[model samples]
Target: MSTPTSTTAWVHKTTIKPTEKFIETLQKQDLPLPTLGPKDVLVRLHAASFNYRDILIPRDQYPFPVNWPLVPMSDGAGEIVAVGPQVKSFAAGDNVMTVFNQEHQAGRHSIVSATSGLGGALHGVLREYAVFPEYGVMKSPKGWTHEQAATLPCAAVTAWNALKDIKAGQSVLVQGTGGVSLFALQFAKAMGAFVVATTSSKAKEEQVKALGADVVINYNETPKWGEVAKKASPRGEGIDVVVEIGGTATLQESFRAVRMEGTIAIIGYRAGPTKDGEKEPGWGEILGSICQMRAIFVGSRAIAEEMVSAIEVAGLKPVVDPKTWTFDEAPQALDWFEQGRHVGKVVIKI
Candidate 1:
């Protein structure tokens, strides 16, 4: 394969605060490719996936400051079209996916790794062609399509990251039907854990149970869902892992659901922001539970490779929403995602 002259990419010049719409802020233009660094690989992207944070960036609601006029997406899959002289692991025509935190190769998350996140601190992956450090890309799963592999970089990896140390016969609790929650449920079941899930929709409860949820609690109907999840846990013990996505609104229930010394991997704040006079509830509830809470940023590149190997061996498939958008429909796709109707990862084909 030969290198392309230019790539088509979407850049958000400013936040939606000005235009209050994505079509106005997001612009697609063809531009000349950058000179590939010695360790870089030039790739022709095939697909990209959406996450909660991606929508927040354009709304100026993300926690981090996005560099203006930046390409904006965290997860992507493609095939290498050209490799720089020093590139070794990948060459022309290798299928691969982009890493979410490009600079964080291994070990644990640090200030630097957290700061180097793609789609936020750095230029992101939603483009026709992109150049990444050799370390920033990893091989796609053996038999998966570009679209399937595309969903892994953000939601899949973050779920896997949060699900570490899950063991057979243990119990895991996943909340709602979002991308991360769905992945966590599947992985937890694959790990031989009894999976308990919470969702408001009656239809989603059945769908989640079909996805191997041992028990599905309707959070709206069952206001004390954590207690219900606790009762449903394997051997009737408390949940070993609670993938806590809701921030303030759900913490008390999570405290009720978790076992002593268990982990609550804090992933998202879906319940929205705290009010001016509203005080965040104290941790007084979980004191007896003695649970540990860890904030899960998406993992390092090493973790991505590890996850890909696991998926290949276990044949774990990511759940992508059926309504796929073409490259030109990115703006509309974002609108659809912001509406919160999809059950699985929303993907756009490049």
Candidate 2:
């Protein structure tokens, strides 16, 4: 394959206020492709998926400072077009997906590996072509589309990590109907765990049930939905695991819903953006609940590989939103995601 001199990329030039349009801060420009390193492979990205964190970056809501003119988005899959001298794991024409953190290969995660994430500390794969270290990309699952594979790195991996230890007959409670939550529902059911899902919209209840949720709680109607979830557990003991995405605003409920010695994986902060001059809610009853609460970043490359194998074995297909978008329609896709109407992962085909 011939290497191209330049490629198109969407660059976030500046941070914007919450009320402002995110697309206003972005500019598409033709950039000269960087020289490949000894262990680098150039990928022609075919598709990319959006995450909640991607929206937060341009709004200055993310913890990290803006890497100006940054290419945004961490999850993508494509075909490799070129490989450098020492690249042996992959070759030209292989389909591959990006790992969220380039340095997190296996075992425990640390500050170093955490800082090596794409789309924030490093350049992301929101462009037509991207250069990645040989270890930074993994072969996509067999018989999956690039768009489907693009959804795996962040949301799917986070769900996999959260439920990896779950056993048959255990109970899992998931909040909302976002990418991670839906993935959690699918994985929990595949693992033979009874799944209890919560959503604010009554209209989405059926969709949740179709995804294998044993019970669906409308948090809107039942404000204390956590207690309801606990009571719904077998023998009314409480949920074995809670996929808690709402931080300060919803942790109290998670504490209420989780049983003694249950596990709560704090994966996201959909309920954050705390009010001005107000600290996050105190630990309150969390300590008394006697549950294990851990924060979940996206998992390692090894975990992703393991997840792919499991997905292949089970023939699990990720539930992507029906609405498809062209690469130029990224702004529209972001707007659709921010509105919070989509029931599953959103994708943009390049």
Candidate 3:
């Protein structure tokens, strides 16, 4: 392919209203191509997926600060249209997906890697072309669509980190039907573990069951569904790992569900649909639960590659929401996702 000098992009812009309130929006524009470094590659993005953080960054509502007026959307897949001289892992026409964190090539998470995330610390892939260091991307799974590969970077990688060290016959508990939870259910089952899933919708409960969940509980009908999950585990000991995403609202119940000294992977902050909001329990309650709670901010590039290999081996398919949007409809798609209208990932085809 000929080298391109310009590309179409959707920039995340934050404007201050006269009332001192902030408005978040995506502005479409023809932008100059990214500057290529000796070890960088230029990707022509085909598809990208949305994450909850994408909704917060533009609004300046994300807890972590971000660069404004940047090309947004971290999870993306495409072909390498060009590469710098030192780029070796990939070449022109190679299919690849963006790494969630540019500096996190392998091993454990660190302060540098944690903050070097694409779309947050670096320019992301919501454009016709983008550039990244050679370590910032990897080849997509064989025969996977750009949309399908796009869904893995954030939600799937986070789920994979949450279930690290999972052994066969272990008990894993997932909350709700969000992207991370559903992926956790599928991954845990693939690892030969028993999965206990919780959801408010009867429709979603059936879907979760079909994903090979050993037990499915309705949190609305059973507010204390955590105890139920505990009892449903092997030998009724409790969950070995809890993919905790509900934040303060669901923390208490998660404590109840995890086994003694089990791991609670704090993944997301979406609250449950409840009147007057849910209560956040005190540390005493957490101490009583005796569970280990730690935040896993997605995963490194090495982790992502490992996940793709496992996915190919298991033939696992990610669940993308049926309702999708065109590239021009990005802002509208974010709004729909913010309103919690979809059960799985809401993607945009570029």
Candidate 4:
């Protein structure tokens, strides 16, 4: 196959405001293909997945600084169209997915090693063609669709990192029906754990149950749902793990819901900012929980490879929202994601 000379991309020009229109900040551009380095492989992206973080990119809400005219998306899967002379692990026609952190291959993460994250400090995978170091991408899981493979990079990897050590029979509490939470539900069930999920929507309670959740709680109905969750645990010992995605708004509840010496994986702050005049949970409460609190920043490529192997072995499929958008409808996809109406993942077909 012949390589294209130019490809289209959605470029974020300035910091977006919550009140401002999302499409206004991002504009389409047809640019020359990026130059390939000695250890690079140019991929022709077939599909890209959206995360909550993708919406934050335009607003510059991500923890990292923005790279101007950024192609803003972390999860994408495609076929390798060309490879540099020094590239040996990948070749033409290899199907692969981009990694969230391009530099952190393995081991513990560091500020320096984590700086090269896609869609933040570095250019992301939104473009039709992107050049990546061979180490930055991994082969997609066997027998998976491009869209399914696309969802693995960010949400799936984060979920895998959170539940890598969880054994069967343990109880886990996952908040919301977002990508990470849904993936957590699936992964925890695969590990034989009892899953308890929280969603504000009563309509989604059955949906969460269908996803193998042993119990579902409507946090809106039960504002202090933590006590209820604790009671639902085996012998009322509290949960073994809490996928804490709500930050200050929900940390207090997590502390209340988790058992002694349990694990809390801090993933995202989708619960919005802390309300004015609202007090955060005191340190005494946090310390009293005595749980292992670890911050998750996606994960390494090695972990992604392991997750993909598990997916292939278990025949696990990502829960993609039925509403898919074309490349031209990228803006709509983002709008839908921002509305927070869909379950699982929202994908863009390239």
What tens-digit string does per-residue lDDT give for candidate 3 at 60-162? 6566557767788799999998889988788899999988988888888787888888888777888888877888889999999999999999999999988
**Model 1: ten consecutive residues of lowest lDDT:** 274-283
The CA lDDT of each predicted structure is 0.86, 0.89, 0.85, 0.89
> Tens-digit lDDT track for model 4 on 1-350?
67787889987886777787766667788978868888999999999999988877786678876778788898999999999999999989999999899998998898865888888888887789998899999999998889999999999999999999899999999999889999999999999999889998877898899899998999989978888999999869899989999988888888899999999899999997777866678888888888889899988988988999998888889999999999888877787789999999988999
Candidate number with greatest TM-score: 4
Writing each residue's lDDT as its tens digit, candidate 2 over 1-350 gives 57986889888876777777756656788888889999999999999998999888887888754477788899999999999999999999999999999999999998889888888888887899999999999999999999999999999999999999999999999998889999999999999999999998867998899889999999889867878999999868889999989877777778888999999999989877555654543666767788898889989999999999999999999989998788897877777778877878899998
| Model 3 local distance difference test score | 0.85
The model with the greater lDDT, 1 or 2, is 2
TM-score comparison, 3 vs 4, better candidate: 4
TM-score computed on alpha carbons, candidate 1: 0.95
- Lowest lDDT sum, 10 consecutive residues, model 2, at 273-282
Better of 1 and 4 by TM-score: 4
Model 1: residues with Cα > 4 Å off, grouped in runs: 274-280
Regions of model 2 farther than 4 Å from truth: 273-284
| TM-score to true structure, per model | 0.95, 0.96, 0.94, 0.97
Q: Candidate 4: which pairs clash?
A: none
TM-score order of candidates, top first: 4, 2, 1, 3
